[model samples]
Target chain A: MKKYKILANEIIEFIIEKNLKRGYKLPKVNEFQQTFGYGKSTVLQALTLLDQQGIIYKVQGSGVFVRRNPGDLKEYVALTENLGFYSNNQNVKTRVLKLEELRLPPKWAVEKGLPASPCYSVKRIRIKEDGPFVIEHSYYSQQSVPYLSREIVEGSIFSYIRQALGKDIRFSEKYMHVVKLTDEQAEFLQLEENDPALEIKEVFSLSDGQIFDVSRLVYNYKNSKFFSQSSDEILS
Target chain B: MKKYKILANEIIEFIIEKNLKRGYKLPKVNEFQQTFGYGKSTVLQALTLLDQQGIIYKVQGSGVFVRRNPGDLKEYVALTENLGFYSNNQNVKTRVLKLEELRLPPKWAVEKGLPASPCYSVKRIRIKEDGPFVIEHSYYSQQSVPYLSREIVEGSIFSYIRQALGKDIRFSEKYMHVVKLTDEQAEFLQLEENDPALEIKEVFSLSDGQIFDVSRLVYNYKNSKFFSQSSDEILS
Candidate 1:
């Protein structure tokens, strides 16, 4: 993880450890700089990223404060396209359900421009906030990362790809659909078969246009909504 | 509606009328200019908007083509934040459910920074492809729009406000949530009570920050998903 990310996590822990409530003021940059021993720029960057994630809101001229309703549906989805496979998907536990190396690509992978031959698959059931949250099936290009381990999958794969393999993710494209859960998925999620679910297919690529992974993610839909923006929003 | 929007709608109708399939190349720019009496710039802008809306896609070498499934889940949620009050909420028919002026405001209005003076309410049921698609309830600022009729609500109130009242819609703020249906909403949508649904609360403000409208929108959740972009996507 990046230094800023580590600091961000520490700040989150601090807030939780202190039981910070809405409108509770967080320490200013100088104070954070002294406390965390991070540079001024690192503290500022961490604060900005935290604000963007809706963890704390900056009230300009006044100070930064803990945002009310961190779990509010609206705040949760503010930049929804980037949800899942990130810090927000944090949980107490993750169970590895399947791992395999395959030569035949699924139809969706072929459609997403994944080349055939030499692919690794990873399936995971993530428990978020102590509840069944997401079931993900992901296929990776073996040529890119080349190796995987249960230990690495237990942590952030993106971090290992960046730190170990020295790869940087450029961007991701995703398509979402409302679907009925299959019997197996229902059992995993502890929901009834055919219950409504949100399905997302995402293609992650490196900055060099190397397709790294294609994933199918299914989220428990009853408590979730997505947030996204249009490029044409007029600024006032 | 703008001329580009009208032209875009005409193109949509053309595709549906002819049952254009995926990879079906649309007419070139000159052809659209000749057929629709549009200028080069107008044709280009309209095509760009259509492409952005996912009604059509541009191929680098071949030409512009009607996307395989313009009715796909992704397309429906493109630019979804400004739905109901705009032309993109296209359909076969719309049924006016209720319209009235009220002196008192809902608690949410004061919460949204709306004035407490008189306001008008409009309820509508929109049908797309011969099915109930959207139910919207809007509260208008009496000072901004003092007069409205069933006829105007039957069409786009934004049009009436723009063409008739000469008011321009600058931008809007929307909050989305997955909510269950109330009895009245269930009856209006003809769905079972407590069924999962997507709900949105929107505040439409003028460029000068005067809020002209507030809306609560509900969508039948069985087949719908939202599509949006993140402003921070690191373009490679």
Candidate 2:
């Protein structure tokens, strides 16, 4: 076999030429190392890199195997960077079921550090291609956006708040967890009873650290994926 | 009634005093305005400010309500900062289940841009206050960490790699989603079959962008939470 540096590429070509699909088990490492006349470390280095790229996965006690078709790599990359990628992929659409302004209660008022009177809330559903992906519940401080309406939410709410209102948004805090679908949420998302949904809760803040919006996005994971970035220090 | 500012604070104090909880509906805007003797807009402004702080949530067709337990404020704040407050708060204990070096297959080698040989795999279980919280499966490039051993992984694998090996880990790409537990994972996590779990798949990279590690973190959502930060521009 070629030297260690080129061995990884050669193996990839073999998989492509052989048409090995996802979940296809590979030959044992000892055999490959002997055939390639390379140290075990060299071979492992190559495999580890591939795994990081999302091309393969390892099942403990089982063995390393090829990953299933990852769909489109470009689309996946785009989805991570731009929400517009949803529309570009032609597989997801935003449907504004309802949008309105309403007051929040005293308890919530205190938690958000508002004057503790009333607040405004916006609700919408996101469709995946032709199917449903998530139901979104968003609450915004009217003081942050004085005049909100259904027409403004029809498109992208983020765009409207920034461009139209001239609100300089800065940073936000986000939380993700899993939750059993409420009966109402299940009905809205067409999920079965007891099915778990991924919940993304976010608090939007301004440059001055004034938080003005909190949103709960619940997604049916049977047809979706979420991605993020982290520092490697956490692993160490 | 006091002016709008103090009225807002009073509203907040009232919520706290009454010990309101999440999902507990609040009074309507008109009711609040009349009771507080303030302009409708002033009351709305106070509610709006509170919403921005993530203290309250609003539901259309319903009313404003607390979103999370008031007692969880400190934990919530730390979580938003990615401080692992929940794990720390619960004082979770980690146990090394298995750590070993194995040969990687050709497919994995190709995906990671490695030479298609052997790699190292580390597996462990993390418990929260003695109960299982998560199971972690990590794979490392043999070349990057050739001397990895079971003993080294016993403590914190992340700490060892950075301190001992002096590997310069920089950034990582992570994919988060939900998955139904398999029979084995369920048994390890001591949960029922098809129980939902939070799944995080990550790829670690060096400063130069070389792939160094791939890890999958599976957590019992009943006992854990995931938090992150983003720009408000994305939300607005």
Q: lDDT of each prediction vs. the true structure? A: 0.67, 0.63
Model 1: per-residue Cα lDDT at residue A166: 90
Residues B1-236 of candidate 2 have per-residue lDDT tens digits of 23655665677667777878655777899999888888898888777645533455555567777544434453331322222333235465678888877776769777864422466777888776647888988887776777777677766666676779876565555666788889999898988878888787776654444566777888886776665544222222
Worst 10 residues of 1 chain A by lDDT: A227-236
Top-lDDT candidate index: 1
Indicate the DockQ of the complex predicted as candidate 1: 0.17
True contacts kept of 1: 0.23
Fnat, one value per model: 0.23, 0.48
lDDT at position B43, candidate 2: 86
TM agreement with the true structure for every prediction = 0.64, 0.62
Query: Judged by lDDT against the true structure, how good is candidate 1?
Result: 0.67
Candidate 1 structure quality by residue, lDDT tens digits, A34-116 = 99999999998888767545466565487877653343332254443433435444443678898888776568557755533
